[model samples]
Structures are given as C-alpha cells and as structure tokens.
Target: MTLEQARAALAAARRVAVLTGAGVSAESGIPTFRNAQTGHWARFRPEDLASPEAYRRDPKMVWEWYAGRYRNVTHAQPNEGHHLLAWLERDKGDGFFLATQNVDGLHARAGSERLVELHGNLSTARCEACGTVAPLPEPNTFTPPPTCPVCGARMRPNIVWFGEFLPELALEAATRAFEKADVALIVGTSGQVYPAAGLALETRRAGGVVIEVNPDETELTPYMSYSVRDVASRGLAALMGEG
Candidate 1:
C-alpha cells in the first residue's frame, strides 16, 4: 500500500503491536547474527559458537565471541525506526507494545518501555546453573570467562541459542499483544525465524491489520495488509508521518 494508506491505518488503530528483527538494528551498524562472523570468526560456524555444548567444550571461545558482540552492540546507536516506535509507545501508552528478536538493546536505548526482547539481550549475562542475571563485564576485562559470583558456575550471554527456546514470559507477552492488537507492524525481519515469526501470523489470524516494513518482500508479505518496501528507518518514519 502507499505511505498515506499505511499512515491512515496506523492513525486509525486503537491498539498496536510492533515486531522488529535484526534489520532494524542494521541501520545502527550492528550486524545481524548470521552476518556477525568475520575476521577471526570467519573460520567458525555461528551455530557452533552459540550452542550450550559449545560453551561446555570451549567456554572461553564462546565467551569471547559474545564479548565482542556486546562491545559492538554497545557502541551502536538506535536508528530512527527505534525512535519512532518509542514515540508510539509513549503516545499510545498501554495501547502499544513492542516485541523484538534482536539481542541488541537498541529499543530500550531508544526509550521504548513496553517491549519484549524475544531473543534476549547481549548486554546481560545469565548464570547457567542458578539462573541469576547480571550485566556483562566490559570487553577488555572479560577474560578467563565470566563465572557466576553467587553460584561459582559459568555465565553465558542472556541469549537464545540455535536449539534453545525463547524466554517463556516474553513469548507469552508477545502472543497476548499480537492477539489484542488492532494493527501489527512488522519491521526489518525476513520472517525466517520461527515462534518469533509466528507472531505475525498470530496477529493476522486474530484479524488484526498486519503491516510489513522492509526493503524487500518477506515470507510475511502474503499475510500483510500493507507492505512498505523501504529500509526500516525510512519505512517506519513514513508510517509515523515523520517522512
């Protein structure tokens, strides 16, 4: 649909749910998970480094990979898409919700309050044994791997790995938001990741108007009420009447 049509749909909606993927953060210079392997990491598979077994076999290596990612994400700023969503949340209050598959903390950094980080955030570390969560140490000081000071067990990035389940609370919250939304805004995601990708379908099935913002068509294109073919920042800005 055209920008004006998309904007009118958004403006008329009473409740809105927004789902974001790595594409949203790409504008801020953070690479998507699959594209993050480069330099010394080019030789290794990303899945090999992200699984629980990878940590059991080589904790230091896994920790190093995550540490680098954390450092990279920490330096990146939120893009206009993130800012616009934050504004929507502030304007709509309880009527707005955000669900994101990206581990980067850009949404929170951009001032989004009602949000679910479906894949977890890279800025925090979780104790594998006791489940305690804590902020990750600075990259330069994160040597010898991080150990849980409370349980003396290994600490892993607070991220969902290849075979792992998404956080339960986040999943439930996202589902509820999609179920009740008058409009569902999908941004930057290719719709390849499941469970998270399923939210768009859930919203559609629930009879909500689904709008997709991406430069190219995605698996979700067929389900969308409107597909805006533009990058995340530009697409979201246009939708919010900022462009």
Candidate 2:
C-alpha cells in the first residue's frame, strides 16, 4: 500500500524533488568516509583528513587521502539507483530537481544534469587563490597539491570540509526546489545529518508529499507520507516499478 501510494503520487506529480545520500553510492562499492579508512589509513580520525584545520596543518596528507578516495569513485560505475534518478530527470525535464549529499559524482555519470551536489565532487579540484574549479588530472598522472593554471596557486580537492558550510548557491537552489515540488523523495539517508536532512520537511511544510526509501526506518520515517522499506535500487524499483 505504501509503495502504491508513493507511485501514484509520483506519477501524477510534475514538479518533483529528490535528495540522495551515501547509501545510493555505497551500492556501487564506494565506501563511506569512515569505511574508506583501512590498512595504513586506519590510524587517522576523520577530522584529521576532512577538516580545514587538518588541511592547514598538512595539505600533503589531506590531498593524499582525497586522492585515494578520488580514485575509488573514479573507478566505480553508476548503479541502477543512479540510472533511475537520471531517467527521472529526463522525464521531469524542467520540473525535476535532484540533490545529493554524496560527493562521488555517480549521479552526474548516470546523466543527471538538473542536479545539485550538496557536497563537493572528488573528480574535480578548486584553486585556493582564483577559486577556479577544474577536473583532476587523469587518475594515473595525478599528484597531490595540484596547481591552478589561472592564478598559479595551489589547488585543493573540491570538497566541503568538516568545519565548512555547504555551497550557498547549491543549498539555496535545492531549498527552492524542495519548497515548490509536488512530491519529494528522500532516498538512502539516515536523516541524522542536518540541513540536508531538513529538506524533506521543506516539502511537507509546503503541502508537498514527502516519501522515504530506505532499508530501515530513519528519524524522518514517521513524518513521511509513505516509507518504502528497502535499499536504494530495490526500494526505488518498487516505488517506480510497473507504474
């Protein structure tokens, strides 16, 4: 009944918004931030590599850590969940808005264009001086601490660090979309993370239906119009299947 209800709402709705989390990318074998720390990396805390202070202390170490992660995502292929969202964007066209907390860039690889990566992507780097965003050198040729071509300044992984806030433009656009959406899908997130997690509420507050798709119940489950109980691919398949 829950799945049917969500399917009905989505089928009829033209303005749709979606928010994806780490679980979507994890389905493709990309480990979570903590899960990536193994072997030699097991000794360091997350704050040591992901915070601005950590970068200031040792930019080399920080870039090394990110470089490994970049390789991991670069090698990964988009899964069924990613393809589903991308297909959804093609259907909705101007009415679709997809936002993701995951920085793996799988959504983009899956062909989702009208999307916002709430966090930064690992496939690219941002210059420290000119703030120019550019793709990383090819995986084999890449080295840590890349320099900018525009201003000749040091480049850092284009990621949102622990102490830093999300990019204002992305957040604002997502908020606007969520507020105006006719249906909002919150997929594969624990809802423990703030601001991004709060996006579902924006849908409900604006009289839009909010649906959750996850294998387990999250904090946001109780408030949703319906919650599909499964992982991202299977859960989304159930919601969208045969409809």
Candidate 3:
C-alpha cells in the first residue's frame, strides 16, 4: 500500500501498539548486541558473553562487555522513530502501548510512558541473591561493578539471557496490548524470533492492521497489510506524515 494509505490507517487507529527492535536504535548509532563486540572482545561470540553461564564463569568479563554497551546507550540519543512514537502515544493517551525487544532503554529515553521492555533494561542491574533491581552505577562510580547494597550480592545486567524466558509480566502486558490494538506497527524487527513474532500474527488474526517498517523484507513481510521498505526512522516518519 501507499504511504497515504498507511497514514490513514494510523490516523484511524485508536488503540495502537508498536513493536520495535534493534534497528530503531541503530538509527541512533548504537550497535546491536551481536555487533557490539570489538577491540579486545573481537574473539568472543555474543552467546559466550550474554549467557547466565558466561556471567557465572566470568562475571568480570561479562560486566565489562555490558559496561561498554551502557556507555554507548548513555550517549545515544533517541531517533525520529522514537520521538514520533512517543508523540503518537501522547496523542492517543491510554489507547497506545509500545512493546520493544531492545534492552537499550531508548524508548524510555524517548519519553514513551506506556512502554514494555520485553527483554528488560540493560541500564539496570538485578541482585542475583535477592532479585532487587536497581539502576547501574554510572561509569567510574564503581571499581568492579556495584554489588547490591541490600545484600552485597553481585548485580547482573537486568537483561534476558539465552536460556531465560522473557519477563512474564511484560509479556502479558504486550499480549494484552495487541489484543486491544486496532493497528500494530511492527518496526525494525526481523520477525524471526518467537513470541515477539507471534504478536504480529495475533494482530492479524484479531483483524488489526499490521504495518511493517523495515529496510528489507522480513519473515513477516508476506503478512503485512502495509509494508514500507525504509529504515525505521524514515519509514515511521513517513507513516506519521512527516518524511
């Protein structure tokens, strides 16, 4: 469909739900986790660094890798896609929700209040001993990463690892959001991951419009009601009647 048609669909959508991925943050120059390893980390695979087992075996190494990522996230600004979605959420009030797979906290930084971070936020750390979550200390604030103040247990990045399931509450909220949405904006995702990919299918089955924004065709391309072949920021801008 044309840009006009997509815009019209968005304009008519009262309960809009958006699903974003790493591509949105890529617009802000933040490297996706799979591509972030560099310099001394060039030899280690992502799976080797992001798993719970990895953290258990070498907490210092894993923490160092995520510290580098946190620095990048702290410096990265939200792009056009993030701003426009925040605007849409504000305009729709309680009728809007954003469910994102990214752990960078960019959506929260973008001023999206009604958002669910499915993968958890990388900027926060959870106490492995007590499960209390807290913001990671600023760079240079700690020597070997901060331990939990309450229990003195090591703090791990509050991110879902390979073996961990998505946070139950966030997943439930996302599911409910899709159920109530009149339009589903699937942006920047490859549509290959399960559960998240199922959201798009759920929207389609529920008779909601599925608008996909990506630079290339994805696994869900065939199911999209309106597919815009552009990068997340540009495509979302055009859909919102900007670019």
Using lDDT as the measure, the top candidate is 2
State, as a TM-score between 0 and 1, how close model 2 is to the true structure. Answer: 0.98
Instruction: Give the poorly placed runs of model 1, Cα more than 4 Å off.
Output: none
Candidate 1 local lDDT, 163-206, one digit each (tens): 89989998999999999898999999989887656888888899
TM-score, cand. 3 vs. native: 0.96
Clash count, one per candidate: 0, 0, 0
lDDT of 3 at 122: 76
lDDT values of the candidates?
A: 0.87, 0.91, 0.88
Q: What TM-score fits each model?
A: 0.95, 0.98, 0.96
Question: Lowest-scoring 10 consecutive residues by lDDT in candidate 1?
Answer: 137-146
Query: Which residue pairs collide, candidate 3?
Result: none
Expressed as tens digits, the lDDT of each residue in 6-100 for candidate 2 is 79999889999999998899899999999999988999999999999999999999999999999898899999999998888888899999999
Query: How do the residues 85-140 of candidate 3 rate in per-residue lDDT, one tens digit apiece?
Result: 99899889999999999989989998999999888887899998999998987865
Scored against the true structure, residue 13 in model 2 reaches a CA lDDT of: 91
Residue 201 in model 2: lDDT: 93
